[model samples]
Target chain A: MQKQENLSKNQKIILDLIEKSSGPLKAYSILFNVKKQGIKAPLQVYRALDKLIEIGKIHKIESRNAFVACKNSNCQVSKATAFSICENCEDVTEVSNLKLSKYLSNFADKSGMKYNKYNLEFFGLCKNCKK
Target chain B: MQKQENLSKNQKIILDLIEKSSGPLKAYSILFNVKKQGIKAPLQVYRALDKLIEIGKIHKIESRNAFVACKNSNCQVSKATAFSICENCEDVTEVSNLKLSKYLSNFADKSGMKYNKYNLEFFGLCKNCKK
Candidate 1:
């Protein structure tokens, strides 16, 4: 992963916007939000997003087609990711449980497939949504 | 989940195509394949894909944005899904491990969040790819 200081101008601008967002932001919405900052064009947003995701500065919630900042300071690569999504409210929370990560990371099957990465998503109602 | 007999014409077409496929099929690719069969619009493809996924006849590989037929005969709902994806060869296999599925289904975190659905994907090189 490249250092944050090495980020290009557009990358920094896009990353900053995502980091400030309270929840995941879609590519179009990110492009819309940064339009005032001279970041025009959907391709530009996608390019920056690709780089941001590559650098582990942001992660895409594949189910939602949205991007969120990596809250784990220890995450240098976006290889292993798990998220809990509230079906009712569409709330997404990054799961950082050590045991769960370890279990998945060490998971092996009879297929003899050695895994290098994994992504898990859990869906249900959140605490607030349960009320 | 609906019975196989309840599937609409478009859904049956899409499901049959996916089931016959050995690999995952992307939305546009599915659209292109079914075009000759009288399904013209992209929305038609998407709608059928959505219903097929809902009924567990298909599962979308979120990482690849591709759809694969559910190989597990016992899986009547598209709730818990796990797959082994070969990074090098792009070979995707639906994982049907009873232990893994049970573990994930019973998984609970300290956040008091109860999950009703989950999707897990593992990425690695397949035996053929590794060779």
Candidate 2:
């Protein structure tokens, strides 16, 4: 079983920043936070983000080239770590539900295809923004 | 409710190309297919993809800067159209379920956050690819 662990000081702030983010965060944003805490160099921030992700505590959002913490704390409940991002506010609100995920998985399994699986990212405004 | 309509003769080929694809497709790949049908200029295919997406007939996978058709025929059952895409083969499996989606939505709603929701796209090899 994968266990959740606290990130290092540098990693914590970066994680904390993303956890509080309204939208997906670019690598620069993470780097910015690191500089504020007396950490220097782009490498430091990237390394921290890389390590945190490897620990399974965070995920990289490929669409926006950003990152976010895994909202789910553990694997017991089997919650997905992916989400839907709003292009306007950059606020990520999980997703529109899991029905889409299961359907895709089943579809691929039936297709007899072998590939790397990625979460789908949709960019758009929320209901409020539409108004 | 939005209605599904067949694309124009030109758009049909583009849509067909994506629909029959086993994985997500990049814009260049779309352009590749477009050229095969005597169509030139990248704008033509992009316009077609844009229009298809607008009518809610097809979806753009932002993570890969690629595209795929909506597997769902209608919105009555209320399916989240995002997916889990494979990095290696570019094959997309729906997800590894709705629980993740519902949870994210509930978390956001509870957080008093108004955001443009996006499906979180993750990248990794499938079970077979791992072997």
Candidate 3:
């Protein structure tokens, strides 16, 4: 887990916007939302996003090309992140199961290849969508 | 597993190109490679890719924004796809493990969210890169 300190102005602005959002925000959308706050360019937003992802303050929902604040308070680094995404509602929820994380952290394939970083995205209808 | 039959001309051409590649191929790159074969526009490649992915003939490496042929022969549908990616070398390998697939397919999070579809990508140094 990396410590969150000495963040740049743009990083802070972008992270604050992502953290405030209830759903994931794409890079372009983040740029659009932060334009009033002096963040004007797409490259600026992307740079801030790269930094935020590097420090584990935010995570990219790769499947959706969207970014979300790191909801897992226990891990500040992005080593074992998992999300449950709703197919119908498009809601993404980070799963904070210690047991599941532990199991995945130690998991290896039949070829004896061990991985230190893994991202798992599960898709299903949420309870509300299921009804 | 869905049967691979009655594929459109573009779908077959795109799938063939992906299957021939040693690494994942991005959509634009696929378009570039297949330009001579009458696939001119990006949308043409994207539509073929969407169809291929829908039928489980290819899998998208979301982290890389690339597509690769489905290397797991046991399953023709994209219900349980997993890949181990080398962070240093950028090589991706599909992992075919029955136990791992079964465990994940039946896994439920702490909040009782059961997912029927999952795509897991593991990142680490490969054997060559570790040397």
Clashing pairs in 1: none
The deviation in Å at residue A26 for candidate 1 is 0.7
lDDT of 3 by residue, B6-104 (tens): 898999888889998999999999999999999999999999999888888899999999998987765567988899999887889998878788888
The pairs that clash in candidate 3 are none
Stretches off by above 4 angstroms in model 3 are A1-4, B1-5
lDDT of 2 by residue, A20-123 (tens): 77566788877876686887788888988888777666777765678876766552222244455555666665543455555434334333444344455545
Candidate 2 chain A has its poorest 10 consecutive residues by lDDT at A73-82
Assess candidate 2 and give its lDDT.
0.63
In terms of lDDT, the poorest run of 10 residues in model 2 chain B is B104-113
Listed in order, each prediction's TM-score against the native is: 0.93, 0.56, 0.94
**CAPRI quality level assigned to candidate 2 from its DockQ score:** acceptable
lDDT of 1 by residue, B18-112 (tens): 99998999999999999999999999999999988887889999999999999999777899999999998898999998989999999888667
lDDT of 1 at B22: 89
Q: State each model's TM-score restricted to chain B.
A: 0.96, 0.75, 0.93
* TM, chain A, every candidate: 0.95, 0.73, 0.94
